[model samples]
Target: MSLGKSRLWGVVARGMAMGAADVVPGVSGGTIAFITGIYQELLDSISRVGPHALTVLRRHGPLVAWQYINGSFLLSLFTGILISVVSLARLIGYLLDTYPVVVWGFFFGLVLASVIPILRRVPRWNTGAVIYLILGVLVAIGVSELRPAQVPATPLTLFLSGGLAICAMILPGISGSFILLMIGIYPHVLTAVHELQLVKLLSFAAGAVTGLMLFSRLLSWLMHHYVARTLAFLGGILLGSLKIIWPWKLPSDEVAAMGDKMAPLMSNTSPWTFAEVTGESSYLLAAGAAALMAVLIVLAVDFWGHRRGAHH
Candidate 1:
C-alpha cells in the first residue's frame, strides 16, 4: 500500500531535508534519508521502476502499477526534493559562499547525529565489522582530501557528471554535489539550476535517472544479502566524512598564496586555532548554536521514528 495520509507529509519533509543536504557540499541527502528512516523504502521503490514496472503497467492498469511501485511515496518525496533544489539551491549556495563555518557547523551536527542510527544497524559486532568501519573511514577521508579538478561543461560532460554524481549522492557518506565540485562541474550545474537552463538540466536529469536505475538494484541486493557488512561499511563512510565537514579552513590561493593557486582552496583547521590560522573571525558561538539545533532536530526525528514503528 501507499503511505497513509498521516505519514505523507513526514516523508515529504524528509525529502526536503535530503534536498537541502544535497545542495551543500559536505552533506548527503542519503544520510538524511537513512536518518529519517526512509532509505530502504527509497531504494526498494526506485529498484522497482525497471522492466518489472513496465510489465506491471502493461498487465495491470495504471493504478496497480502505481501501487506496485509505491508511486505516491516516491512522488511525494521527489516532489519535495525537487522543490527544495529549485527553490533553495540559490539561497543555500549564497550561504555556503558567505558563511562557510556556520553552514558546515549545522551540517556537521546533522551528520554527527546520523552516526547513531547507522551504528545501531550493525546486527553484531566483530573484528570484521571493525575492520570494515576503519576501511570505510579511511576511504572517505582520502576522498575528502582530493582537490577539485576543473572539467568542461559540455553536454556529454554534464550527462556523465550527473550519472557519476548521483551514484555518490545515494550513498550516506558522499555528497553528489561535492562529487560535481570535485569533477569541476558543480558550479556549472548549480548555475543551470539557478538560471533555469532547460537543456543542461534535462541532460543532468536523464543521467540521474539512468544511474538511479542501475545503482538501486545493486544497493537493494547488498541490503538484502549482506545487511551487517553493508551497514558497517556505511557507518565507516559516515564516520570518515567528518573530515570533510570540519568547519574551518585555510585560505585559498585567491586570498593568499597557495601552491595549487585556486580561488576557493581550503584546508581544515581546528576551531580553537581557526582565528589564529585565518586571521579572521571564526563565529564560534554561531557555529555552536547551529550544531546544537541540528543535534536536537535529529534526536526529535529519531523519537518520531520509534513512535511510528510502535504504531505499526
Candidate 2:
C-alpha cells in the first residue's frame, strides 16, 4: 500500500504505457498492465474504492481509507494515464494516419509478444481452461468483426459508450477505443479530447468511473477463484486481437467512401496483397522492423519484471 518515490514513478510510467496503448483502437491498456505485472493490483485497488472505503473514511479517517484502497498507487497510475492520453492523443492519431502499417505493426507485435508472459502465468491448463481460452478467442474475434454502428452523440450515448468501453479497456485483449469505434463514438470522443470539450469529457469520465467500480469487483472475483482459467481466457483474447491490428489492411469500400481513412473496417491482408490491391508500398521492411522492436521490448520488460519479482 505504500508507494515510495521510486515505485511511484514506476507506476506512473506503467500508467503512461497503458494510456498510450488505449489510444490505439486495437490495443488494450489492460494488456500493458498485464505485461507490466500490475493487472491484479490494479483490479484490486479499483474494486476496493466504494462502500468499504466510505465506511472506513467515516470510522477511521481519510488517511486510513486512502491506504485501504491503495490511493497512492491509483493516483500515481492515473496521473500517468492522464498525462499520456492528453499528450499522445494527437501524435498517435497522426502516426496511425500517416504510417498505418508501421503503427499497427508495433502494436500487433506488442500484443503477440504479451501473450507468452500471460500464458506462462497459468499454472496448469485443464480442459475447462482450454475451453475458456478458446471461447475468449472466439468472442474477441467476433467483436473485432463487428462494423461500427450509427449512433447519436448525445450525453446519454456518450455515458453509455464510456461505460461499455471502460470494461473492454480493462480486459487484456479487448480495446475500449475499439468499443467506442464500434458504437460510432470514437471520433466524437477523440474530438472532445483534442478540442478540450469539458462537458462531454466529464460525461464520459463519469460513466467510466461507474463502470470501473462495478466491473472491477466481478473481474477480481473471477480472477481469484479461477486464476488459471481467467489468465488463459485473457491470453486467448490477446491472440484473437491480433487479427484486428494486422499491419496489412485493405480499407472497406464503405470506409473509403466515408472518407474516414483511419477508421478502417478491419479487413486484413498480407503485405503483398496490400501492395497489389492498393498499389501502395506495404513498407514491409519498416513494418517488420517495428514489430521486431516491439517484440524485443516486451520480452525485455517481461524478463525485467520476473527478475524484480524474484528480488521481492
Per-prediction TM-score, please? 0.90, 0.93
Q: Note the residue pairs that clash in candidate 1.
A: none
Per-residue error at 142 for model 1, in Å?
1.9
Candidate 1 Cα RMSD (Å) = 3.1
Off by over 4 Å in 1: 154-156, 190-202, 252-262
After the best TM-score superposition of candidate 2, give how far the Cα of residue 231 lies from its true spot, in angstroms: 0.6
**Positional deviation of 41 in candidate 1, in angstroms?**
0.3
Candidate 2, residues 1-312, lDDT tens digits: the string is 799999999999999999999888789999999999999999999999999899999999999999999999999999999999999989999999999999998998899999999999998989998998898899899998887777777888888888899999999989987788777888888788888999899989999989999999989998999999999999999999998888998867655112244544658888999999999999999999999999999999999999999999
lDDT by residue for model 1 (137-195), tens: 99899888777777877888888888889989999978887778777887778788888
lDDT of the candidates, in the order given: 0.85, 0.90
Highest-lDDT candidate: 2
